[model samples]
Structures are given as structure tokens and as C-alpha cells.
Target: MAKYKLPKPGELSSSINYNPPAKDWMDIPVEFKPATYPAAAKEKDLLTVGFPNAHQWTPEDEDWNLPDGWEDTVIKGIEERLSKYRSFKLFMDVCVRCGACADKCHFYIGTGDPKNMPVVRAELLRSVYKRYFTKAGKVLGRLAGARDLDADVLKEWWYYFFQCTECRRCSVFCPYGIDTAELTIMGRELLNLLGLNINWIAGPVAACYSKGNHLGIEPHALKSNIELMIDDIEDITGIRVNPTFNRKGAEILFVTPSGDYMGEPGIYTCMGYLMLFHELGLDYTWSTYASEGGNFGFFTSNDMAKRLNSKIYAEAKRLGVKWILGGECGHMWRVLNQYMDTWNGPADFLEVPVSPITGTRFENAKSTKMVHITEFTADLIKHNKLKLDPTRNDHLRVTFHDSCNPARGMGLFEEPRYVIKSVCNNFFEMPENTIREKTFCCGSGSGLNATENMEERMRGGFPRANAVKYVHDKHGVNMLANICAVDRAAFPALMDYWVPGVGVTGTHELVANALVMTGEKERTTNLRGEDLPGKEGNE
Candidate 1:
């Protein structure tokens, strides 16, 4: 749209630059200029969650008006976290600065910002850790790569930390097994100490805390949204289905991210979920409360994550369900799989999640008693539980982009592809390295999917988008499928920016399109209301 500083003529490969300019890291001027997208937290958004320091603020404002004892607050916060999480201490201590993981980051590969590199991003905190805690840093100082926690350092943390999508792709390449995501989370938590947070993250967190879901959809609105979805279902399949809400003694309690009830692609995916469950005759009730599976809380802090995630179990127990069927989401599963059991409880009330129809036990989710939508669909496909017409998606040349958290954090790589391949006729994977655990982020994961950060999101999204472009050109791919809500929300912009012809959607949205329901009217359109490829102009 405008003439920007174009890259040098020969700047072709991302491998071209792994080393920063020849200067001391601290002396290197970090310019958070027009290139850096600035988005600040809104007071109204934070007010619901009772953020005491929440007031009108902007990233461009010079006076952030941090608390009086801000330096001490940060030091103490780091100390407490270090003491609590051994992983933090180990990550701080273990890095050898070999730069093996440097090129692996999506932001660094996309923006060429050295600080975006996982090693250097961690160094933002690691420098503070060395200054306050480490012995070598106390004596050697810059020689030991330690730096002070001054204003500039704080600003740098705010800038680059959000640049990370908390995608652990870097961790996959690290020889030391260092996780930059954990460091990024620690950075965000420390920044939140000074009441510094973005509006996108703070807003959803507050909404989820009070209104039961991230979009702040209350009981009435939640019911209304589903009513609209049921209307759409009837229009397509010629069958009206009734799903329960907060009904006690239900066999399964279904929960999806709040975005599913409100946002695009997500709402379409939600329609797919409803139609699939209706066809299976699965006895499941919905919950107006705990309507979110994508935990924005996980992006904030462990306490906030625990606070928001507590609803799922609370609602499940209240509804008297045997197990929870979680929808397709990114960080939500990471929390559900890794943190929920440890943070919330043994969940002794709910029974282990087993498919009552197929009788398949999810032993991996035995502790949490939660099943992923893909896993559920895969099981159903394996059993031929639903008649699927893969040819319905013949026009959609699909490729799967593994969302970072579920791919790296939980290792849910195969189940989603199995479901996608089972539902769609043609399937392609973005290069071998970029498809599975080493997959890049959507450039807008965590809480970085704000509109103000569009430019930065475009840059961070390049690696993932570039891979999509490769597949788009080679495989004639048009539909880029994923299971993450953030991807569904953010990738349209990315697709338009980098890979213009390609589109992003949820895996189950495709399944719902291809599924042949019992005694349903002959379908002429897919879930998005698009005419089916071959079904067009047919009597």
C-alpha cells in the first residue's frame, strides 16, 4: 500500500542473518520505531478483572507511570517465580548461546530483529537474572552478558516479548532443551506487574473471568448464538437439532472457545461440532458458563490461567457430566493437558473420558478427562460412525498448518491430520520441518492477535505464510486448515498479506461439509454457505 524500506536485492534466505551487528548487546540501540506496532491495554477492559494499576495508557506514551517500587517489584517477582519453577532456573542457567535455535523463531525469521531470536529474547530476562542472581554477572558485568533492569530494558521487554507468540518452535531446535516460550511468559507476567499489558489479552481475560467466556458472551447471548447456528444447520441439512445447556446428569459436557460462538471461521467450526454431535446421537449438554476452551489466561499468568480454566471443571461438575469434550483450540489444550491437572485438581468428580459409542479410551487425557475434537472425530472416522462424502470438498485443496502450542506443547500432531485427511479428499503438508512439532506459529498466537499489531503480525506470520505459499504454488492449495482459534482469526490477514489465494479454516468445518447425515436433505452448499463444487446447477 505504501513505499516501505525494501529489503536488499539479494536478501533471499532467512539463513542469511543469524548474527547481530558487531557490538555489545546492551550497546546495540533497540529502536522500537514505526516498525514496531504499538497496542496498549484499555482501562475498561482491565477494570472488570480489578487491575489496580489499570488506567488510560498507550505504548507510545513516554510515562507508563509504573508503580513507585517498580524495580523492586520486578526483582521480587522474578525471585518468587525462579524459586517456584525449576524450569525457569534451568532455562536461565543452561543456554550456551550457540545460536542453534536462533533461526527457528517465526518473528526473527520474519522480521530479522535480533531480539526476536529465541536466545536473545530470553537474554532480555537472562540479563536481568545474571545481574541480580548470578555470581559471574555480579563481577564480570557486560563481559558476562548481564544488564540492568532500567527503563529502556523494560521497554525492550514489552516490545519484543509480545512479538513472540509463545510458540515453542525454538525449543524444538535447542540442544539444551531451553524453552523461550517459558521465558516470554515470565516476561509478560513481570510486565503485568507494572500494569503493563495489551488490550487484546487483558480484555478477553476480564470477560472470561466475569461473563464466563472470552468474548463476554452471557447466558442469553450464548443461547442466541447457538440458536442462530441451529438455524444455519437446518438450512443446510434440512434437519432441526436440539442441544441441551446446563442440563444435569448429561453424559458429556461440551465446551468450546468463546470465539466459536461469536467469531467467523470459529462459529462455522462450532456449527460443524453441533452437526457432528447431532448425527452421532451423542448425549452432550452445552454450558453458557465455561464456554471457552482457548485459555487467554494461559497467556497472562499461571494464576490467571488457573482462575479462567477453573470454570470448565466447575461447570462439568455442576452439569453432572462424566467427561469434557473440548473444542479445537491452541493454548487451551496445553493448559488442559499440562497445567489443569496440576493447577486445578485430580478432578475426582468426573470419570475418565471414554467414547461411549466407539468405546475408545483416551488414556493420554485420563487425568484431565478431556478429549480434543480432532481425537473425537478421528475415533468416529476409524469406526465409520459417520458417513463422510470426501468429494464434497473436492474443490478445496487442503493443507494443514500445525498450531504451535498443540503441536509442540501437547504433541497432538497426528490426530488432527488424521481427521483432516479422513474428511477432505486431497491433503498436503507444509515442508517436512514446518508441519509437525517444529511448526511455526500463525504469527498471532498467545495474545498478540490485536488489530493494532497488524504490521508486526504480518511480519511474524511470514514464516508460516511462506510455507503456505510454497504449498499453494506447488500443490495448487487454496484451503489452509488448522485447529487453533487464533489461526482462524489471524491467518486471514496473513493469507491476504503473504499467500493471497489461500484461506484458513478449522478442520471440523471441512468435516461438517463432507459429512453425510442420516435422512438429511440433499446438500447443495458447504458449511460457509458456498455452493458445493460438483453439486452446482444440478437438479
Candidate 2:
């Protein structure tokens, strides 16, 4: 008998009865529209920066201009990666299908698509592994839940794999510790072999390869933008802070996502860094060369991730700094904590990162020698080093959105919240399940933040926005602060769409506003130039 029996069309069914579950994997079909894919990687963007494997193609057309024997390329690529990484092999073999991780996926939960289920998404790749590598699948075929690789399977792989954000939320609930992100990266690597990549990912990666930063901002341009920020700092604090660039013998080298220097929420965070460093009189220099802490190639392939990550350590050694201090970012920290030491290590040229201002040593990042900005600020608050007036933020009610990577990948949970609480008296957290280790993605991570996939982003982002709505209604929260660049860039749109009137901001922006700078005029406006709650009509 079929495990699932359908009710007759237009017929009423028992309202309180439980439905049967599917017994066969083949019973489902997966398909997606063109909007589900990222914008096609442009040849000009790739060629301008001379990215390897540069090709001319768009997903709008049927023929992808794939190289000869592309099928052999993907299958062989999988075979090679399986042998190289034992984690891949073990993850491929062990799965009891108890379904603990199935419901944990945001894509599956939001869209209700079966393929978005984490276990099923991994099975798309594992089924092919079974057919080619395992004896049971080779003999039993479909009955053993294995299928032959073909164009249809390849298409399905691209559609579903790109849907994932590599957030690793499912792994937290899995019994066997099966991480779907590992499979997502592997699938992307194999797809890259065929030159199948999204434009938002490939473009930034290519720009970072040649220009030394994403958005292809040049050396003098980075300085110009920074000087503009400095002008703003002087206007507020009556202090003109000047940070060095590529200067050797500095005590520390500060690296953050290139997005920080750009306008909006990120630029304010950059100002926060500048003001805090000036307050402590810290010795540090910025590098126009290793300007970007984020690695978009991480969204593409591991080898590319390593190549981009190498510049940080190389620049540190060149500048003769003690250690590296990274700014507000999500995947940037993930790479630093999980993969930086492994990919490019022996940062023996640098000393351990100890907060000279607070005297706190980051033991978690001792091996990699990188410290997060929030960690540094939290320590200062713990030691009561900063003179802060939390009442400056009395006009706003704040809530925090834990960006997916730092929450799940690294478990760096409490540092940012501690800093926020120390600075703002009116802070509220979202629902318990919607935060911390179980946080939802901004719906546009892993380089899927393209306009073409806005619909998909909206669908995936609904879960997080829905949680924000709950708190906004309950706690009257008008500010939704986070610590990631993508969160700052993407949350504004998500908030506007799902829960209007909720503004997005970086954690440091709040910290900077509440700080009391010495010998400065009495503050009347906060960072965004909004009037201080009760300090209105002041000069």
C-alpha cells in the first residue's frame, strides 16, 4: 500500500487525523524558476580582474557554454574531494534518517519545499555518491534511494544548493553531526569546475583578487572615503582622528570588511571603530592592500577562500604588527575562527591579540591571532574603561538580530549583546528560539544577496522578520541592531517589507553615540544625527 493516501479532490477530510508520511524518496519532484538562481556571473567583471576559469555565459539561456565532458568533470570532482576530505566521506556514509534536522532548515520551514529540508538537500548529492561508489546503490538502484547522475540531477543540485546559506543551523540539532554546509561548499566547488557561479559572488571575488578589495575600491579611493568619515568624527567629538595606512611597525593591524568604508549602517560602524581607537590612543594601522576582512570566495570554493585570506597574515607580517583586530562582520569571523589557521596559518610573525585598552586576552582566537571588535569593546565595558551615558539612547528601543554565521559557526554569542546592554538601557531580545545558536539568516548570505533572488530572500527572511514583528509589537522596538555587514545591508529591506518602521543598525554605532568624549561640546545628536532623547534644543 502507498504510505500516503490522498483525499479526493474537493472532498472534506478528518480535521483531527494525522497524515501518513512519504515512504519513497522518488515520490517527490524538485523544480525552480529562473528567479531562484543568482544573477549570472558577467564575463567583463571576471575578465577585468582576471579570475581563473573566466567564461562567457548567462543562466537565462538553456546552453550554459559548458566545457566538453562537463559531466565527467563534476562526477570526477566529487570523487576527488571525497578522498581528500575524510569528513566528506563520513558525512556521506552515516545517516539514520531519523529526521531531527529536517524541520530545522529555514528554507524548508518558510517555503515548505521538500528539497529545502537539510537532510534531503544533502541526499541530492549523497544519492549520486551511492549510485557510483556504493555496492547497495549500484545493485538496488532506485529502491536503495540512489539515482544516476544526469542533466536533471545537475539542475536540481544547482537550484537547491544555492538556496542554502551555509548557516549550519541544522547541524545543531542533528544526531550524527551531519553539517549540510559541508555538502553545500562541495557542491559549489564542483559547480565552479563548470564555471557555474552567481554574479554577486564571482564579481566581488574577482575584484578582491586583483584590486585587493571588494567593490574594486582603489588605494587613494579608500583614503578619500576614510577622510570623509574623519570629518564626521570631528564634527561630533571635536577630535580629528587620523589612522595610518600600510605603515610598518604598528602595534596592531585592523582589518574589516571593505563594506565598512561605504555609506550607511556600515560607515557608521567604521566611525565607531575610529572613535573608539582614538579614545584609547591605540597604536594601529590600516592596510589598503589587505583592506577586506571578508572572503567572498568562501561563498565560491575553499581554494579561492585560502588565496584571499592569505593577504591578511602577509600584510600583518609586512606591517610588523603584534596581532590582527577584525571589525564587525559575519562570514569574516567564521573564516578566521574555523578556517583561517587551517588554510593559512603559523601567524607566528604576530603576537597574541591582547586588548591593550582593557588588558583582555582573547584565548579563543589565540592560535589565529585575530580579535573581534565586539570582544574588545565588551572587555572595555567590563573594566569600566569607557565613559558612557546610556540615557543618550533613551529615545529608541533596541533589539538584536544574531547573523547566522557567528551565531552557529563560531558560537561567539554573548560578546555583542554585553556591549549593547552596557551602552543602551532599552534593549530587548527576540523570541528564545529565534536567537543565539538558533538564529535565522538575514535570508541573503553565502553571496545570494542579488536582486534577482529577492523573492527567495523574502521567503527565507520571513522567519527572522516574523520574529522581529513579534518583539516590535510586544516591546515597541524600533531599532534592530546586528554585527554583520550583510545584516546591515539586507535587514533594512527585510524590515521595510516585513515589519515597517523598524530600523537596522550596527552594534558599534550605538556604542559610539553613548560614548562621552573628553573636552568635547555637550552632545545634542546621536550617530544618525537624530536628537538625543532629552537633550533636544541644545547647542
Candidate 3:
């Protein structure tokens, strides 16, 4: 149990101040106020992944129990990373302090904390880089904006780095294209070296390392969970969906975030997958071994991310499936698009993905050999492969939230909208600035979606919620649709706090809602068991 409690919306919104104070940002010391941040990683969770200096500690304590020569470890880690990644080095060296990205961060807009500005957040690390690595800093000191790395500075790094969602919205605006998310990644990596990780992130990393999923769900439990969803699909549509697990010789190996296996609204999306696959008669099998598509290890370090990501290709080869089909997850697609091929390799064992229903070859994913679900569904809609009745979802006026990673990380902009519009009749976009590549984060991303950090999540999500409020007021929007599992999990709480009447949903859930399955009984309700607009009286 945590000490933090969420405040009333009025009080919470009133507390924010967007303007910076008269004092310099450097002089503003880090504060460990209760409820503002998440708890420290437990020793057991840290030990599960063999993180060094694993010990019980709290951020509020005066002594953080850092290992001896911890400063040397962080400095060496920075040096090694700077040499290994050219982009990191370029980001460290090329910043002109132009402030082009200052206002782009959601946290800066919500909380008005100057350090939350992407530029200042990077400077927290860049200043340390200057003091230890740069010659100019060795001579000029303060004039060069160099600062010593001490206990306070390390605490500041932990405080601010976790505040970032690593959405890359700021990078989209940077002239030098500085990825502040990468900087936060580096900061978290350095922190993990000292076992200074939050429980939400460290727990999932450890679970995914050993149990193949973030929830630590075992093979049997994973099967049972999907089985439960199968039963629900039968009740709603009067058609039982039989999905195989860990079955070899399947044409496609389907992978989705484990949240979709059980979490609300996400499970409906999972039901959507089951319904759609049955309709197409697609030869796909679910893998308990590669049960998770979302990677929390990506938030920890490069090595950990690689270690967890290696499972997918390994399962694909073991099951002898062709190319993989990924579900509606944000960072998962980012990892698959950018890092997986580089970390895991050419995936030469897998063939380029060709949709069995539409026969559309995904040339963009030829190297990774994995296709996003929206890309597959959009192709089906484009080819008129599936029988869709958009009127089924007429009760809901919907708006699309372009998830952070998919939009900016992979440039997956139009595919999901195409799918959503094809399934739901009343489709509306969030304000232009808030959608597509320049979209805002759900604030709970990058492993910050913990109970104790509720205040920060709400504050960081304010800009996005504000935009939703805009559409809600004007168009009577009732449901928020997105592709990310994190968005599915996070936005329900976000909308409840900010825009109460609006509900959160997945794109595939919308697809399944409108999908007219063959031999299905007379449908009285949507996948969620809610009656359709005109079917309410019939039910």
C-alpha cells in the first residue's frame, strides 16, 4: 500500500503553475514530496533481474544507500554509451539551447515545472557530462554550464528522468532532432546500474525476464485467461472462438500485450482479434512462450530490452510460423520497428508478411518480418475482404488518440484511423495539433503508470485530456479509441478524472463491434455486452 491519494479535479488542476520562477533552474533543488513520484524498486524485484546494489531504500530517506564509487559507475556508463550510440553522442553535443522543444513536453504544460521542459531535462544529464567529460567544462566550470555529480544530482536525475514518458513529441519539434526520450532512457539506464529503479518498471522487467509476461502469468494461466475471453465471445455473439496456443505449424504467430488477455476494454479488443481471425479462418496460433508483446525492459536498459525481445523470434522459429502479427501496442511497435531487427537480427528464418486474407505484402516490415495488426486490418478493409456493418457502433460518437510511440516512433498515422472509420460511423479526430505525429502522451507511459504516481500521471495527461474535452464538448464524443494497450489501460482512469462521460476503447474492438461474423446469432449487443443503439429495446 502507498501513502499517495489522488486529489479532487478542481484542487489538482488549480495546483499547477506553467510559468517558471525568477530563480535559475539549476538552483532549484530536487524535492521528494509524497505522492508526486512513485516508490523505489523493491530489493526482491531488483534481485530477480540481478540488478546491482539491490537493497531496500526509499527516496525520502536522507541516504539512498548508494554503492561505494557509484559516481565512477555512472560516469563510465555514460562514456560507454556515448561511444556505443552515435545518436546519443550527437544529442549530447548538438544542443544549441534553442528552446524549440521547451513547450512541447506534456509534463511542462501540465505542471509548469521548468525542469520538465525537455531541454532542461536533458541538461540535467548534459551538465554532468560536461563536468566529467568535456575539456571546456574542466576549465570554465559554471560558465560552461557544468555541474558536479553528487548525491543531490543523482537524486535529481531519478526524479526528473522518471517524469518523462519518452514519447518523442519534443524530438518532433527539435531543429537538431534531439531525442529527449533517448536521454531519459540513458538516465534510467545509469540509474538501474545503481539499482535506483521504480517498482512499476523493475517489477515488469523481472517478470518478463522469467515468466514471459509482465504479470508473471505462467503457461496454464495464460491459456485459461484467453479461454475465459473465448467464453465471453460465445455469450455475446453466440459463436465460440477456438484459438490454439503454443501450436506449431501455424501460418502466423499472433502476439499481443498480456494486458489484452485480461484487462478491461483490452480484453474486448482481444475478443475482436478472436472474432476477426475466425471470420477470415486465418491460420494463426497464440504462443504462451511469447505471450507478451509489450516490453518494459525497453524502459530499463538496452541489454535487458534485447534479452526480453529475443523471445518473439525464438518462439516464431520454434513454432515454425511465417511472419509475426503484432497487436495494438504502442512501444511494442516502436521496439519491433526500430530496435528488434538490430538487437535480434535479420530474422531470415521468417518470410515477409503477406496477409492471407488480402495477400497484401508488408514491404515496410520486410526486415523485421513482423506486421502491425492495424496494417493487416486496414488492408482487409481496403480490399473489402471482411463484411463490416458500421451502423452497429452508432450509439457511440468516437475520437481517435494517436498513441505516442506508433505515431512518432514508427510513423503509423493513417492505418489505425482507416480501420476505425471503416468500423465506426461517427468518427471524429481530436484537435489537429493533438492528433497524428504531434500527439500527446497518456502520461503513464515509460513505466510510470503506478498508483502512487497518480497525481503526476493526471498532471502529465492534462493536455491530452484537455484536447478530448474539446471534442467532447463540441461533438458529443462518448468513446476514445486508440491502438496502444497502455493507452487502453491508462486513458480509462485519465478520462474518468478529466472527461468523465467518455469511455476508452481499442481500434480492433471497434472493428469487431462492426464485424458481421458468418453463422453468428442475431446480435443484440456490442462486444462489451452493451446493447446497440436500436437494439436496446430488443435486449
* Candidate 1 RMSD computed on C-alpha atoms after optimal superposition onto the true structure: 5.3
- For each candidate, the alpha-carbon lDDT, in order, equals 0.87, 0.87, 0.93
Question: Which residue pairs in model 1 clash with each other?
Answer: none
lDDT of 1 by residue, 1-539 (tens): 89798777676665488765797567775565663564788778767776656777777777777878889999999999999999999999999999999999989998777778899999999999999999999889878888888988998899888888888999988999998999999999988877788888998898888888888888988999999999999998998889988899999999887777877878899899999999989999999887888788777778888988888888888888999998988988888988999888789999989998899998988889999889988998999888989999999999998888888888998889999998888998889988898898888888888887788989888988888999999999999999988889999989998989987789889999988989899999888888899778754
- CA deviation > 4 Å runs, candidate 3: 1-21
For each candidate in turn, the TM-score is: 0.94, 0.93, 0.96
Residue 524 in candidate 2, Cα distance off native in Å: 1.6
The candidates, ranked best first by lDDT, are: 3, 1, 2
lDDT of 3 by residue, 264-361 (tens): 98899999999999999999999998999999999989999999999999999999999999999999999999999999988999999999987789
For candidate 3, the lDDT comes to 0.93
lDDT of 1: 0.87
Residue pairs with backbone atoms closer than 3 Å in model 2 (clashes): none
lDDT of 2 by residue, 388-505 (tens): 9899888879999988888887887899999999999999999999999999888888888788888888888889999999999999999999999988888888899999999988
Which 10-residue window of candidate 2 scores lowest in summed lDDT? Answer: 23-32
Off by over 4 Å in 2: 1-34, 44-53, 537-539
In candidate 3, position 509 carries an lDDT of 92
